[model samples]
Target: MVPSPVEMFRDLPKKVCPECGEYIEEQAESYMMECDRCLANKEE
Candidate 1:
């Protein structure tokens, strides 16, 4: 039997930002490697 979306999501590893040690939110379709705050700071 296939697992529900929530169950599948719960089983996935937590995504953390390597730059600032912050917990990154998961996106269904994203290529972001770092948290927004850090990324913004990096661009300055």
Candidate 2:
């Protein structure tokens, strides 16, 4: 079975924070999944 390039890249580890728009650390263990700025500016 041959794996596609996109699939291979998708399987790689991510290092971007979803919440604070900060860069995730290589050794970090957890993600917030929501950007702080986004949340703060969210429509109420």
Candidate 3:
């Protein structure tokens, strides 16, 4: 049987911030390697 859309999403790997080790939520079509907080701190 084929997997449902929800199941496919659940199987996707979780995106984590390399600098802060926090889970990164996908906000757009582009991929993000770090969380917003870490990115801001890095810019300082």
TM-score of 2: 0.31
Residue pair clashes in candidate 1 = none
Greater-lDDT candidate between 1 and 2: 1
lDDT of 2 by residue, 1-44 (tens): 88999899679876565656676445446455645556566755
TM-score of 3: 0.67
lDDT of 3 at 19: 88
If the candidates were sorted by their lDDT against the true structure, best first, what order would they fall in? Answer: 1, 3, 2
The digit string of per-residue lDDT tens for model 3 on 1-44 reads 99999999989998988887999888769677889999898899
* RMSD after Cα superposition, model 3: 1.9
**What's the C-alpha lDDT at position 7 in model 1?**
98
Angstrom error at residue 21, model 3: 0.7
Candidate 1, residues 1-44, lDDT tens digits: the string is 99999999789888889999998987879888899999999999
Which clashing pairs does model 2 show?
A: 19-34, 19-35, 19-36
Off by over 4 Å in 1: 1-9
Q: Model 3 clash pairs?
A: none
Each prediction's whole-model lDDT (CA):
0.91, 0.63, 0.89
lDDT score of residue 3 within candidate 3: 100
